[model samples]
Target chain A: MSTLENGTRRSPAIHAPGEREITFGEAIREAIAEEMARDQRIFLIGEDVAAAGSVFKVLVGLLDEFGPERVIDSPISEAGIAGIGVGAAITGMRPIVDIMFGDFTTLVMDQLINQAAKTHYMSGGKLTVPMVLRTTLGASRRSAAQHSQSLHALFSHIPGLKVAMPATPYDAKGLMKSAIRDDNPVVIFEDKMLYQEKGPVPEEEYTLPLGQADVKRSGEDITIVATSSMVYVALEAAEKLDSIGISAELIDPRTTNPLDTGALIQSAQKTSRALVLDEGYSQYGVTGEIASVIADGAFYYLDAPVKRIGAMNVPVPFSPAMEDLTIPNADFVVETAKSLCG
Target chain B: MSETNDTNPSITDLDAEHWLQAYEQMVMIRTFEETANDLYTSARMPGITHLYIGEEAIAVGICEALRQDDYITSTHRGHGHCLAKGAALDKMFAELLGKEAGYCRGKGGSMHIADQETGNLGANGIVGGSAGIATGAGMSIKLRGTDQVSVCFFGDGALGQGLLYESMNMAQLWKLPVIYVCENNQYGEYTHNSKAAAGSMVGRATGFGVHAQAIDGQDIRTVHATARLVIDRARKGGGPAFLVCNTYRFRGHHVGDIDRPYRTREEEAEWAKRDPLTLLEDWLLKSKQAEEHVLERIKQEVKTAVDDAVAFAEEASFPSESEVDQHVYA
Candidate 1:
């Protein structure tokens, strides 16, 4: 398997090691491992992130690699994490704080939205926070409602924060590197299901700039805007739609907060008809944001009304069958695209 | 040798500077608190202000003993702590008036003034928010291998918060460099300290293995002297310390509330007799180090400084509502 040049530890393939590809989970761990080794200023603070290697093993073997001083295990204190991140960031140190799940981010919203977000502007941009918070989203497993959520929309609505949700292992390393080097507070949400989904990644140090959207698949029938884990599902659906004579394009807005609206609008204008897919619940979801953009920017270029496919308006169920019904999958995307084309 | 042999009597050079600077800082704090009261009552200021009027001794006595780079976490009653840490009065007043020149660029009002340059962390409106921050700052200091101390200023009411216990537990476990200064200022807004506080604050501090003390906060000299001993102890690999300063706030919790009704005018009169300014004035004059004219000139200079600060705040611009979109991140 290829290891990024920044001292990224090579991980055993979560899937079969064919083609030496790394999963999204393995890519994140590599990025963290590499960043810590490169900069003495970087450290990790989170609950069970040390001994248990996190609820998802995204931080597995990190404690052994860096020890407790650098790979800290904190009490179950989300507020403490945010508060400590502020102090550590202010004291000329860069900390890559970990919140076990995206929902717990609400508990420390005051520190994230109020303190970390405004601290730079409050200082009139004199002081900047280089702290990185890494969290996991989506519950393809039976982890239940609270544990499985995509709350990037809330963060995107808040100003002065950078958000990176890289879909590919290559993008994960590149975007995480950029997030670490960023002057502003950044939140990176990695999907739990994508942890085992492997892809080809080059063994090189690189960075994906913020506010750029990656055009995963090019087509003319419709532009499908997706994010995080939803990008893969959207691609699968795009391929299915292509067999049915519908040419669908897929664009992944890797960073949610500083959205790649320029890319989204450009592609939406090309295909007049568009479909926004998000893993979050339909209410005020990322789909809503994408729809608003298509309505505002590409309004005149509409052959059909913009459509949005998202999770049901209820919590994700622990039952695997109910979860399949609750969250949008390739079937939902394929159906939505076919209906739009019809 | 017998007369001079006092174990803690040799207040280190920095300690002595701390004492003199405490007095200087106390004067600045007292002037700022009094000026805020004047400006608030006269309607020159727009919002309600929590004047740290009588609690000046607590902030001055504790913060002066800290290194210039050491951190301090403050409460809503934080103007005294901010000024004591050398926050420019112009910026401070500008902040209170919601001007762009304020420490928080008008986003944070009187309750949330912060100057990171002077190591004064922001003043928090939430009662117990600063305690965890103070503990974390202390952890940062210990982790960085510096003798730097972080002092957390909270009221008797905060002693009940989980934040206090959680922070105390961590500070004790890590042997962090922090000082928990509980300004038991007789009242937490409308509640009396005797009614609100369950156990002695010093007892709580000691329960966590933190070196603890109970000091007379009204006496600035006694407060500074004791603070030097404790602050020095922490600076020399000694862990955290907790000092419960038994004090009183002369004004109501905020400008709109009148405290005189809760305690009779006669009761207020009794507390007023122990005014910190009068106490310091007596100490200065009785020692024959200064005359009436000298003290008056100093007070006049403070007045002139206050006047200029007010004028500066008046001229300072207010950040537009659109500017709120800026500075959410770096």
Candidate 2:
């Protein structure tokens, strides 16, 4: 077993002949199952999590495997669930409290922001809330303003919360494991659109340390920093940019808090131009934060100003075309990258 | 105390040592609050504090029945709860004074003191905020297969909050070991609870199928008796219980606000006539639970201890500026 800098243990990767491939949902389920098996203190509580296997079916078979005691179905109370997660975490158990949707986080703001996030510091380091609030973030499911929101940036804005947006199955599994083991409160936002997406994952135990940016694709002309579902969009944009003789480097800073500003700055310095992208709203959102960081760090090396492409500053609409237009797409990334590189 | 399965255990049944200890705790809380109020008024303390001057019995009574390892989630006006739950006077005063020797190392101040060693989940600043946390503690206890009970102490003002009802519903549905203790001090800040809350307080808990009761908050013996029964039942997996302690607050909502147009002097005098400390003293004297000299001695000792706590807080250093960012994350 290898220990990460955050003091979490990771199992050695045992490379089989061909690595196993799984859906993003399955990878997340596997991560939770593995962590639960390793630690008896870990349990999951949420609405429809037990017998229902969750609304998204992401937690299917967990209740059967872990029993009803380990998997609990809670009432429709987000604030209470999050608060309970904080209380349980501080009192010796590691709880994974699932908020079914990212938009529902508004119902849990007081508990997450005031209670769970501040407990440790308020207690003068005498206590720690080792908990993870797993929720889905994405629009375009025909879900209206209340059901759809890429609110990960809101959580990232908070001081004590560690926000992780896993774009692939490999990162999802590894980051979920690390989040469960971290001493502080971590909020993991899984894109609902990426649940069925497939990616290669190691069969053996391995974990990814948060705050480490992953170089999804390497290039030289311009740097593109993206997050969560936007990483895939940026990847597509990078390919299109290549067709146009413009090479774009893609960096996903897996976790927003404790962000790898150095990696982003280094990449921007190398490329001399950067474009930050996110699915959250453009106004005071994650994209703006990343763009500013790069602008500040790579100001001298940049040939052009650091740009950002984010979801339009509007509540997610239910209409298909309206919803599609509101989100940041690969075409938009390519268009933004062209404007920056030109 | 004499063993009895009968409900509503009286002060007459309490043994000498336990009885004396209960009186000492009440005195300690009263002295602590008085000293804290003095500190705030004299500008010896950095932040504002909500004095627990009138409703000492509820804290002393409920906490008396709790084990050291049992959990408790307190409120903004939490000095009495901390004292009753076994927090050190010096650290509490230090926290109020923003000293490094404080319970939260000068970070939490009055509204956020927490002691893990004694199972305090921490005092919450938001009204009705700790409802979920206390219920979650019950969930943890149930999962861990422990007999410890988790208690949530909120004021009557919290009745307007929806989280409490949600927490109670879940607590009852899952049969979690929790006690929701509402010190209905008749007001939510400056507003009267009658104007803020609708319907019966106990009915809210009963609506969720939770075992519920309303008790006299000024009577320490009755509060202790009901708390003991409810806490024991919860520890044995009887599910959550809602306790509405009918009490009153003697001082203003906060130290800064001294004006009193919301309440009349007559109302204050009426509540003060049945003051928890005075009622307990009268009960002790009338029931011959102890001599007047012994009670006076307890009061004197508590005064000295509180005075020493004030001195300790004054002598303690403030946390360095570097500590501002420390512990933001574990």
Candidate 3:
């Protein structure tokens, strides 16, 4: 019911009272700054985290505040940076390593998965690597095949590492804080398209738990579980469904690794029709995992088979029109939801 | 071997106690590897192990120069480095046997042994995996403003890995206190270093602006002297340095490798003449730093220790099935 001076209907308010509005990018910067201020042991190491403030500018002004020692600028070596993160984390330091792109995770997979993820477990609990690998995900920015990728599913499939995907500015700040404090390694996948999107985030210190899910809209006809940038698309689809007299509930799973299957099952039980969506490929992705969870937990209560909407199984193209066709949008979600409801 | 008695200050400055201890450490490593080979041949051990037979001096000499608190990253052929860095023989044996009392509680076999209390970060299965970790540890030391230095032990096979150059560049650019020790043990798995490694080993380090030195890895005295100066310089914040220890692996790459078709027996015999343990024993006796009785006593001590470790490993229990899911997260 809240509206701005232009009389346009604002997005549904999700935060508690007295929260201030901020962009997803600003929320990330504030979280890093505040966490760095609180813990001297926490430091940032990556390619352009220092003087450049990162390619996305999500780490703007941190270099001057934390100095060169804490905010380190590494060479263009993902493996080296990730290795340093694991080493520093185990040796009494919390390191937040930034991989400039999610696609580049392939270059550092050995250090990230083989070394960082397995060190604590392989060491029989003698060592703990409290590190955060922050990278950007999602496409449609014309980044082509190399730069743009929503590879959260790959990380979530691994057992030893935690995966967090924050869809809103509020969740962005909160989840980042929790990730820094966690004793295990966490990979945070931020959608590049949502960096400029504005949402309410508290100015005071707060942290959201990594594995919890949030219900963006309470409805009864269908339950739509979405992640990262897809959360907003799902919300828009819900509005369109409301005009057609079909209620669609939206659930945002902040972290994919420790998935909130209980909340997802409860929502599916209420609606009896489930639609799982993601920006990643359809096969062996976040949508498939959610669909499996729903089938296992809410099969008897469901009125229809659980539906999934995902990006087409192909590399993201460079052209905007072609890329848009490959990626799922609000219209695609609405069409999928209507079919599931019928 | 004769050069050990030369008037070089680095070798001459070492006293009788240092020489005796260094000789004993090398003996322990050789005995341990021989026992490991026996265990594998007799089907007592389960997994594959890369024997560090001929490269004992590099581990013993470099570790002798380090303090108890300084850090060191190791590679797959890590048993010698583990022993030299003060890991207990029994626990390492227990680890090889995949017992609950092992360093990793039966999860990690020979390739992943680590003792944090002794400053030995876990050995990596990947060829050049530990370089970044050593560099990061150096960064941590610099940030903490500590005098501690970190050493990274790798093989000639890792020379072509980009992670090494990446880490070395960062270490030099930031003046991180790290010592990169490359044990150039001839063959990388199956290929010779000449075919696999391009240019020169020293050139790889010097190109990164790191002070590099190629030393005789078979000579424990030289290894000890060079490691002492380089480790001390790094601790003093003089920046990172690289040491290319030109060594040879007396055994195959792994337990099952026949080691034929690539290297000839004549080449193996040629390198065997420079066996580190023999060189050290010759130096100890010729220099009159240790008597025959003293040398025999050290051998007896090492054999007893290794025998006790085998017995302990035989008696230790395997982990329960219920605990398989533990330690995946902190």
Candidate 4:
């Protein structure tokens, strides 16, 4: 084994290329570590990012590898941290500001919407805010109300911001590097439940461009578009549908803003039917956004109405059964896909 | 402790040229704001404008202490700060008129004018919005190992914002080089400062362990001297400092806010007696800094500059409809 720049152990070069299975949290940590080692200007600032290594432990081992200066732990100030990220990015620094929970974005509406999103445009392109705001979303572990939410649709509505939601470890590592190197502001929403989910990630460095959608499964009957944690549920639903007679195609929109509408529209046209699944509220959520995109682009080719499945409108409850019913699971997707295929 | 002595001795120690420049900058700001008022009255300018007429000393003095590369964040009433930091008069007028030659290409009006080359980050419409930005700029300076200092210019209304305390705590904790200048103009829009704020402005900064001071904002010399000391300390790695300027606004909050419902005529008249311009003029003549004719010539030069800017703005065209969607992203 060889040591990485920050003293992390890595496997030596081999004649044949191979993939290593790692958790999504490990992939995110690797991306941040690699980027910081490459550029001294890149730093992490957030609540409990240092000693606690973040609430989800996604940032574990980063504080030790890089000193305190690079791994900064901020006070409980979301607005201040967001504004500071914008300010530092404009001046000369690539800051990855971590907002502990996605629902807390309400506290930083002015900083993110008014300041970061509009600074580049308001400056007439004179200033660029090259920053990444990382936050966690989704509900499953019984964390109710303020702790659980999937609010990517709110961020996608705002211009001048790029939204990324990586479902797998491969996409998590690749998309994060792209976000850090991006010239404009990007918001990365990580699913809380997917942190421990294992997936194959390459040993070599790689990056996935923003606005690109990945087609996880191919089918001729129907298309299912999902985001974040729902992407994994859609793939699992596809497996169940294949055992039956129905074949379902799965599309994961890794980046919500600057969306790959072309890929989505093509899939919808080929399948002639589409079902959008989201963990956010059904009304005015990512489901509606995807349904509209397909309606506008592939309306002629569509053989059936585009259906959508999203979380219940009510707030996530504390009980396990209620919370499970609130968030869409593989069973829900399977039922919805069977209806669409029929 | 002699009452007969000069309230601030450092005011008399400045060179003749320094006094003249400060006096001219204050005059220029007055002329620019008065012209903007005239344009608004005649319906020649678009959108509402917040005049920095009486609080010119705060912007000029704090900016004078900063170098060309030092960073500054401004509030909605930011024209004075932009001018003091070396923004072009014609471009500022063009921006107010929503013309194509404006600093933000007619996209950002008077409230959002910014000159990055001069280190003047764009003015914000939200109160206390720039506090965190200034703190982050200080963090950037520390990370880059630069001796540059950042100044955040906000009003007393912003004192209640959580961002101010949050940013101050971080800046103090990291020992970042920043100066927080609160231009207390006695009003937050229509409400008086006393009715809206509690405790003391100095107490807020001191609570964060930052060095805080309050000075006479009407006296440009005093403002200049105090700003010089605080800005010097910050640049020398002394962390953040807060300076509160006791000032007032002569006009209403915005151009259309004519009726003085929040304040009385007599109260306005009393503050008008300590007009920053008249106070600076009295000091200049009493200190023998310049003759009457010299001051008059400087006034003429400023008037001509303002007139030229207005004419240029009148002649400049509005941005084309095709470019409306441009500059939304980098």
Candidate 5:
């Protein structure tokens, strides 16, 4: 299927007209609601998750459907909330803890990094923390330093945790369902900028397996590995490069920890050039790691060194002009691809 | 110095069998810590260990009040809790020695021992780390409609952490079945609780509207009696309770913390006078519930069990290198 101008693909007309389109936020909500309905053990807990329905309105109807017991409203206690999720998961209940902002992950580091990530291993496979930590990433909403950050790299660095960054509505719904079913702790960082972005999602049941990369588009000239919100930018860049006779392939590796290194390397070998993109800081970030992996795996086949673009190593400024300069854009990707082709 | 009153359990409330059993567990714990200390001093044990020599009664008493399947989260100094909760002696010793036969298959050593079968949710190295885990267990119990109670065993040192308060707030608000048991050994590491904590321990729990009480931890009868009341209340939906057990540690913080000038010799001698094992033995004899020979026989039996456990741990094998990367995820 061909991609639209905005880089979102058009779903084949297999479903009813009214049931075809859904937003990224709706897809996430639908996934949780469906999972909670299927499994009585699944519960939601966070600040303003119930009644208030989240500040972004992602969980607007969950409280009404599940009630207060399944949909809990917790105080502004990030560490305690994450610890509760870990504990509940270890015992039996599958809890989806809503961390309102991704930047607030700093507050829950001890519980997430030390406790949740170590329980299964330290207990020697006796205890399993089957939990999901849902939070927002990306930095274009003018939310400023403390509220705006792409902290997926922080969780990805830890071994026990599985990190997922879904770039579309279909992937968002499918990946969330898979995360709930995973026996290990999974952190899903939803790009805050893509919450309302619309795409087609089937009304039928489906789940996307974690650690698998999806090819958004295939081309023979160059390979582009993008994550989360960067997938759209890469897609737009691919279209622009196609018009200029420079072909580009786009691959979205939904999960970072169990990265699809084989697919990434194979794509790099086929294209003979590769570029990695992420919304996190450039230094010691996801892009750097992926680029290193591609360079190592496709060293003999590569025509040029693998390049990476990430958010500038600085706190996201409040001003729109300064903020736009921090993250990767389609124009930058196009220019980078042109240089690599030359 | 004891907060126990006539309301607490006397020899009349509990029967002779329980008295003998409590005495047996206290003696076992004292012997275990002493043996563990000997292992460390002789350089036989691999890592450092925190002794639970003087704090036997509290663990035995509270655990006796819990059901076999009820949950309990422990602290750094946690050998007593594990044993009192019914962990096998051989496996516990194996865990300490990092043997494959250990409770955690040698993955967790002394500080991180976890026995799921015994409802022991692992001992934490971080101070006050298990507060939320314990509270979350209570939440799960409530959601699942179980009558089980969750006991969170921390130290007076944990009162310095904000997590305990946050957990206490939720446990109280949601009316979760959790008991926050603070083993107030009068010291938080090197500093005394008086210097470390700002307000009273009970006051902090009461600030969250949690049912709070203080009891003499050296007396197993009082600890058992108070724990029963609180655990029963929480199970019946009375919400969370905070218990400050006024106990003392007979040895230094860890096996290596010798020449400790944190407390004076006079203070240690004073607290040692109320050694929990001695207190129970004396009570057992005076009440005529147990004969002196019977108590002596119990101690001899405990000594055999401890010796056998040490031998088992010594004979056990270390985990293979192939298992190094296993169990990182389920």
Candidate 6:
């Protein structure tokens, strides 16, 4: 599906679909609430989903309107929330289960993979688990390990689940609606840091279909593809690269499972140099997939070994300084892009 | 035999129709597995499957307690669960054959079997995987204002997993409409229950504030009664319950490959003596619920069904080569 705004051309707009301004959290909340209202089959369940309305209040006011049943609250049981969502989805319900933080998702990998991911295929396409798992993955707020992580890479690695990492509110709202409507299992990842961040989005119902990649910025110097929270850092780096007379193409392969390798292959063919950035450890992450896509799809076009910039290989340290050292920042992306360009 | 009503009869509240239905479900599970086991050993099947040979009662007992549309999340040893929840036998066999007509085009094999229409959420390969799914199913029903309950059938080994605890906490905290059925058949693969599990099953569930029970899994009737009590309450918003069905695997961990020397022959014999199928048949005849000729006919019906299932699977074609990527995404 075409992005609501003009492709790669940002213009100030008042009532645009993807550019109409709204806070990221508000956009996400609206997506969830609107879907629940539109389809009687859709409902949400997660920790603090009710009166407390989610730890971040992203699900705020949901319980008041839908009551305990629809806007249900639950124990801090990430695995159960995910498992329940899978069950409900397979049983003719569309559930948006919430995992308060991304780190907790490890507790529910079985349900997400062996259950949600495989059900449709295993049942010979006789079953479809149409479910959404919504949670935050960001490290800037210093939540530390066990609370903070951008593990979109892990979910994207799974074959049956569709992984969505929206860099802005417009993408978040649209992508989430698409996730809700998708019959296969989908993982919708939101960077906690981006929740309060504002960007334009349409006020009415809309869906940004999954499996399509969005070329955020087009340039000729180098192509830099980043995911989730790293999209922000990549944009920042792109801005810095512009000052240095290097134009970098920034591509956010918003949906990772059905990855937009075609886009990466095309961009690599043009730029002839590439740097992939992500918030996960560099080893065996989404960046690896991007690298392979380029290597396999456009091998001869690269001017430099395709560079991958990502969070350092280590548990996210609790200290802010250590955390800063662990996660890839805009400066790190900028430096990597410059080196690759040289 | 003077058995108390509370002595764990599997189907306590239902009339003759429901009782017969439960019996039929159990037969479907037993017949499907036994015949499939024979075929599997002879190299007639393609993908390797974990047979639900000795545990028909647990699935039958628990599923009987659920409504037609109530959801169930099954474990890797899930053939019986799928059968009991109304998965067509022919389709299941086709899946085993990895045919185009198979459930997942033989891509998922036996570890993952699902039927959305009948509300059989899926059978998961990962231990304790169904807990979260069942909990989420409960949440969905609660959200829709319907009283449908969700059942999660996990092995006792699953109790040791962290996900089980996580699910228990959520289900209990919100009083979600879910039932956590721990089919404790004494072993987790080759490991003994004592070696693998840390705390009491009921104790773990109770700590999470869920009403919990320990029941006799060998007695299908007993399982039925206890499960009904918990399942009924969930449908009416009484919240979730945990039932640890203390059962035993009369066979080896998997199919006919009885290679594990973990449990002694004496233990096998002891459990064999409690075969649910035999007990139900005896009761059906002695209580005049069914006649001997009728029981024989029922066996024939199950056998014919299995025979047709094998025929259907054998005739089904393998999925076209391009199907590998067909169902990868929604």
Q: How do the predictions measure up, each by TM-score? A: 0.89, 0.96, 0.97, 0.96, 0.97, 0.87
The segments of candidate 5 whose C-alpha lies over 4 angstroms from its true place after superposition are: A1-19, B1-12
Clashes per candidate, residues 3 or more apart or on different chains: 3, 0, 0, 0, 0, 27
Model 3: per-residue lDDT, tens digit, B1-330? Answer: 011122223653679998888888889999998999899999999988989999999999999999988999999999999989999999999999999999999898899998899998889999999999999899889888999999999999998899999999989999999999999898899889878887878888899899988888898888888888889899999999998888999989997886567889998999999999989888888988888899999999999999999999989999998879999999
When 2 and 4 are scored with DockQ, the better candidate is: 2
Clashing pairs in 2: none
lDDT of 5 by residue, B40-144 (tens): 989989989999989998999999999988999998999999999998889999999989999888898998888888888888988999998999888899899
- Model 1: how far residue B26 lies from native, Å: 2.1
Give the true-contact fraction for every prediction, in order: 0.40, 0.86, 0.79, 0.71, 0.64, 0.83
lDDT of 3 at B49: 93
lDDT of 3 by residue, A264-328 (tens): 99999999999999999999998999999999999999999999898899998999979888888
- Go through the candidates in order and give each one's DockQ: 0.43, 0.81, 0.82, 0.77, 0.78, 0.61
Candidate numbers sorted by DockQ from highest down: 3, 2, 5, 4, 6, 1
lDDT of 6: 0.79
Better of 1 and 3 by lDDT: 3
Best-performing candidate as measured by lDDT: 5
Model 5 iRMSD vs. native = 0.7
For residues A223-316, could you state the per-residue lDDT of candidate 4 as single tens digits?
Answer: 9998888876787788788899888888888998989999999999999999998888998988999999999999999878999999888888
Q: Give the CAPRI rating of model 6.
A: medium
Error of 6 at A48 (Å): 3.0
* Model 1: CA > 4 A from native: A1-20, B1-21, B105-107, B186-208, B259-270, B286-292, B318-324
Tens-digit lDDT track of model 2 for A1-342: 112325432222232458776888999999999999999999999999999999999999999999999999998999888988988898899999999999999999999998888888999999899999999998889998988898988889888889999988889999999999999999999999888766678888999998999888889999999898888778778888899999988889989997999999999999999999888988998989999999999999999999888888899989997989998888888888888888
Candidate 5 lDDT at A22 equals: 88
Report the CA-based lDDT of candidate 4 relative to the real structure: 0.88
Q: Rank the candidates by TM-score, best first.
A: 3, 5, 2, 4, 1, 6
Interface RMSD after interface superposition, each candidate:
2.3, 0.7, 0.8, 0.8, 0.7, 2.0
